[model samples]
Target: MTLFSLVATHADLDLETVGILSSGAADVAGSVDVPAVTLATCNRLEIYAEASSDDPAALEASREELIDAVAETSGVDRDTIASTFRTLVEDDAVSHLFQVGAGLDSAVIGEREIAGQVRKSLADAQNAGTVSGHLTRLFETATRTAKDVGARTALGSRGRSIVSVSLDIAGDMRGDGAAFYRDACVVLIGTGAYAGTSLAQLQERGVRDIAVFSGSGRAEQFVAERGAAARALKMEELSEAFSAADVIIGCSGGNRQITAQEIRTLAGIGPEGREKDLTVIDLALSHDFTPEVADLPGVELITLESVKMAAPAETEDSLEQAREVVDAAVQEYLTERQQRSADDAIVALRRHTQSVLDAEMEKVRKQHGCTAAAEEVEFAVRRIVRKLLHTPTVRARELAAEGRTEDYVQALQDIFGLEVEPRERPEREQPAKRRRAEEFTPAELAQMAAHLQKVPDGGFCPHHRPGEFAVERLEVAQRLTQAQAS
Candidate 1:
């Protein structure tokens, strides 16, 4: 089977489309015949599937199947769904997932939440019985790479998220900065994971006057479970909750949109019938509040779009370090996957050798009549066969790692007339085609050296020893210098 990914994110589509797709496309994983994982986050709706065949026509059919599944479940137009998704195959697909798991593709860079979301997506696929061994390994590797990125980069120290970024925008708009979070009368909408996280963050920021309202009517139980840090709001008390709140946060993105008129009627009602300033921060993907609310007087609005625009940029050094981790991790995964392709050929060679050994031993037993000489001859022949097979076995793995499995298979066919079973070997870009040290300036090399120093010792494989990457680059530079002199 071949790997493929269909990605629709805020970078390519509007947040409304993403939200709608994520919420509505629940049965997408099961709709396909192959192993599939659907990662539906607020910012992206991604489908990772292992196609039953690697043929171009078969891959296209798989894409059509997924599009049909999503459209059927989400009530979205088939053409629209097709247009919104960007298909990635093999290496690109694997790299994209790693980037997402590492939080490098999130609205807020290095956000820790996407990593867990990635893991949960895999689990959901498993529960749905749509996951395969390859898909499981792919997701598990992505999760590990994400954790490695977090531990090795400055992103772990920052711990920023979409919620935090939204609050930062709210704080800036309120004019008192973060200090306003301490005294703000905040009302949170929704009782989901985001709502729980927002509550914890609010409490961490010293906000005590917090109330939570669940459109699904679970706020009472949710608040009770969380203790006294927050209070639950009944649907009838929304007017009063809005009137008393300084900051409103929407996390429960449900079918119903909180209309502009509803907020204008009850928001910030002073005792003297005056409207006070209010900041409405909508972090929901489906938008808990209407966009028209921003037009209301004395009200400010912060949305997922606004938060995305206001997301702070990470330091270049930290970002580069994180990217190096991702690159290394992707390379390691690709190497291991490629090495596995050699297994069938190795088995075929060993099987053929064993059959020949058994035939020769039978002849020896017939000629020597089961004498000690026959046993001695069998032992020597078996030892010789093993010794002869060692180089070919090692060569098979080396060739496969270099994306030359076909060459090794052809060699076996030519030399031994061995017919190995055809296996799926996804095509990958050769590493030599990547950027070389000869293409970089001295200053760039120096910067790379500095970044390499920040990378933790060792790598995903023993072949990648500490500082080995740096050594390779320097060797390339020296080779270039020698060629120029010659």
Candidate 2:
């Protein structure tokens, strides 16, 4: 069965739409007799939002329509198509693609944040039951590959982030006095990886007073680990914390956690009745703070997009280096996958060919009896058939490896008369039932070997006898030389 994959970045499309599109593509592929198709998205936000799509009926209808189309065209049941599609998504190819793109194998990178995003996306898909075999395999493999790449490489060993970029931006914002000891109060909203990193950098900048907020239980430990004069608050106390802060940095997993109205409320109050020029940095893909938050009086909302724009040329260069590493890893993975696919096909082909040969030999032996002459004839026939089939079998495999398998497969089917032909109902009626063939015993095998020894030279067989077989010949020659020395 052939397998194909489609990968795209999740920029603006809703999560459910992505899932529906993937399901549709998989269904279409199955209709065309394609065994598997996997749809993978790189953006975490797009994957996460699929579960809460406003149109459930529309989504279900789309899925059913696709499945029905495939079932009608391919003559495969909806259940089988569904199961196979599910299986295909869970395959290794999907995982490798994710690992290669997520900076896990990057040369100079420490972005474990992408890993978290991937995990969350997969989890969402899984929870929604949208993760069929294909997607499940893809995500699992992607996660494992990412983990392996991370462990084996130095990709996640560095510290390059928005916090570092912000430090540089802070340098630009604060001028010469930025690096000096400052008693600034920094309020970090959402205690995720990005927030924690920013907090550490802020501490290094000598911002002694820090307030960290998170919905997760880890927020308290995250605050204590920084060793800054810090306090951890629940997500519910965000508005209260915003009023007493000198600078505000927001990062959260929720879709649009902070709004423009909240920023306005923070701006309206402060010591001496003067509004604070709050710098709000949002690292979440869906955006923690609204774009309108920037319009609030003396408040700045910096998103991932904005940070990317404000980043220096050096940061861009580093990102390029990381991309190169990921590309190399992807190339390596694809090469390995191709080789594995070829190997699996070859092994299965060999087994099928051997089974056919064995059945034919057994039938000939049973008809002709186990006499020496009869056995010789049977052995000769078997040898001749094997010799005749060898080149074609090898050629078919070579064609398969070269991506030209169809002609070779058709040729084999034609030669063997194995192609299924349509028959009339009257012709098919009262067809003789085929009986189960008996297996050969050890004694029968030994007798057949002895009978083969009596076959004439180049008479349905090239070799002289059973002993003349290459393996037997080698053993006999070795024994004769040993006997002569003794």
Candidate 3:
């Protein structure tokens, strides 16, 4: 299977469109195709799909058809599609996408929430049987790379999110000189990550009356550790706690448990002369409190989405910087991918050569009527080929690592008289066919012009260019120039 990576964002299409595109790619492959496309932002989606074929030409054709099909189906411009994909497969962009998607690039950097999201997406693809061997490796590599980058870099040192910001805002809401711990009662409903964080923030803000309620004893130890009042209550005590609490932070995974009736009941129980003002913070995927609670005489409801907006601008900038880190990582990943691709090609070429050598030796053995010596000849041939190819293979890998894979690959093909189908070429062509003088450096342009002067139509020389060295020489020179310049 040939792997192709694409980058897109969530806003580009609805869930239905995503489904259709995934299903369509799968149909083309005659199997469930897993898209390793990750959502880096509201505007970005990265897709890595694989096409199967033993023949490189057929594979290339199939890939093109798939690209065209996706563009048509999504009603997006082809250039946009290509550009998005280039970012994914290209060295810089791929690394960034992986990092960002992994949540390592989050504003509250290294929050661990992004890792879960990435895992979930991968799980969804796996469950659907869309993840094949190629995609599996790609995703696993990306995940590993993200983990490594996160560990190696200081990007996650001070990552904070809207939750952290909310705590700051909450502290400000309680006026200065009024000790939070002495003045107001803070009730944290639910024992989720966000709730725990909010509770911690409240404590940090000097909130004296901190109460934590969970359906089980899970949070009791945590609350005790924080030296806060804790109670394990059944679902029924929600209204009583709501009535008694001044600030309520709700972060749960279940359905909307705080109903309108519950809010009304809480409001009704408050002192008639001086009504209670309840602040409800809902930080769950499915809201923990009903919107109708906002209409309560003295109740204020804050959804997760709203709180995210209220987060400090600096927090956003931090997240943006984290994203930049991710982008750098993606570029590194792309370079690795290029090297890997070159390695795969070399491996394939070696295998093919070995097969031919084995066949020829076997034929010679049969002709000599010496079956006993067949194994010896086979071993001898294998050693010879390995020795002969070792330097070139090693050089190819080195070039790939140095971002000079094209030269080594071209040289290998030329030397072996190997016909690399179009799909095997790593370079993508530009739409406008600009002249060499405009595109290449003066030296490169002169070299090309010189070489063309020797050919009938400014094409390659068949004899001299037939061997690997010819291609290698040009590529190495180009790479050296680039490296020196850099």
Candidate 4:
């Protein structure tokens, strides 16, 4: 399966459109014949899906189809869709997801929250039963890539989420430039994760008077859950609060445009008014109002764009390190994922070989009429079969690890007369031994089959041979269920 990524971030879609797209993202993906995950944050919305093939025309058609779907679902125009969306395929898709999970794609690079967001996105898809094997491995790899970026790079160290960065911008825009939101009357828009995060950040910055406006009707519960001295206001109350607010932070995630006409009543307020120079921050992808609202002389506007530019982040060193780490992770994910191609062939070959060994052993038993010598012959033949098969299996895996798997796979098919059809998910089997792991992911099973080779016939006494046979735990038996795959 080919990976497909459709990303709409702060650079493209506004917070509101992103919210709209995300609101029905699952339903849209559920309409397609593939595994998919949609991750929506305060600053970005990304959809990762798997398609049937890697053909350019096919992928392009799928891309347009997805864009049209989002346009219809969110009620946005084609131009907004075209301008704000970026489509990535296969390798680029894998790399881009790693970058995002690592926080490099965020408006505020290296944001720590994105890693958890990535995990949650994958979990949500899994819960919905929408993830296939390839998508599952891709997301599992993404979380690891994020962890590596955080542990091995400076980008993670100096990273901050958009929430904290917006707060910083608010403080900077204040006339005194001394963390002004600490004592200001703050009006926070929206009642989602961003709203909750913004509220917490405002509280951290010492803001006592806070009011929230809910676009999706979740405000009362949100305020009550926090147990703070905060007021939850209806949408209509926004204008009155806008007139009296010292600072406004928008996390309102919905498609409704905050038209300047709605708030035009405050146009004539002078610089000497009670809340002169109203600081309005649009943290949402969709602006709180048309850009013209900032034109009002009495208001100073700040959006995520300004926050990103003014961010006091040390990014150069961290970014380069993160890129290198993601590149390595992409390679690792691809190589390990491709190892499965060799697995089916190896299993079939060994099973075919085992059938021959069993046939020959039965013949020997019949020839010698069940003597001890006949039993010894059966043991000797089994050891020989294992020894003969070991070299090709080990070499194929080594080549797979080097990303040179096709030749080995073709060689096996040619020599053993094997027919291999690639599978997305492995066949689940009940264990023959202990059931420690309830189930294994496709990626894990691939590695287990390739790397954890089983010893011959469970015979620990290799005194008849030149090699030592270590009896690993029964879990090894559970994993080496070649017949299950067959």
Can you write out model 4's per-residue Cα lDDT over 1-486, one digit (the tens) per residue? 467889887666555567666656656665665667878776777888876655577777767767777777777786777667888887788888888899887767788878988898888888777777778878888998999988999888765877888777767767554447667888887886677778887887788889887777778889999986799888777677767788777777466756555545643345343446677788776566667767766677787777767766555777899889998998888777668867766787887898888888888877778888988888888888889989989987888888777777677668877655556676354656654644666667666554434434454542433235555544644456564546
Cα error, residue 45 of model 4, in Å, equals 4.5
Worst 10 contiguous positions by lDDT, candidate 2? 45-54
Order the numbered candidates by TM-score, best leading. Answer: 1, 4, 3, 2
lDDT of each: 0.84, 0.51, 0.57, 0.74
lDDT of 1: 0.84
Clashes of each: 0, 19, 24, 6
lDDT of 1 at 78: 88
Model 2 Cα lDDT, one tens digit per residue, 119-236:
6556655454444443444456556555654555544445445456655554456455364327566777777667766777787777777888776666788867766568887766
Weakest lDDT window of 10 consecutive positions for candidate 3: 26-35
Highest TM-score model number: 1
TM-score of each: 0.78, 0.53, 0.57, 0.72
Over 1-486, each residue of candidate 1 has an lDDT whose tens digit, in order, gives 679999999899889889988866658988778779999888999999977766788899888999999988888898998998999999999999999999999989998889988999899887777887788889999999999988888976688988888887888888776689888999999998788888988988899799998877899899888885888998788889889899999989788988888887767543343456889988889888999988777788899999888899999998999999999999999888777768888989999999999998898788778888888888899899999999999999989879888788778889999987645435343665667656888777655555544444443234566655543446644444445446
Q: lDDT (0-100) at residue 291 of candidate 2?
A: 76
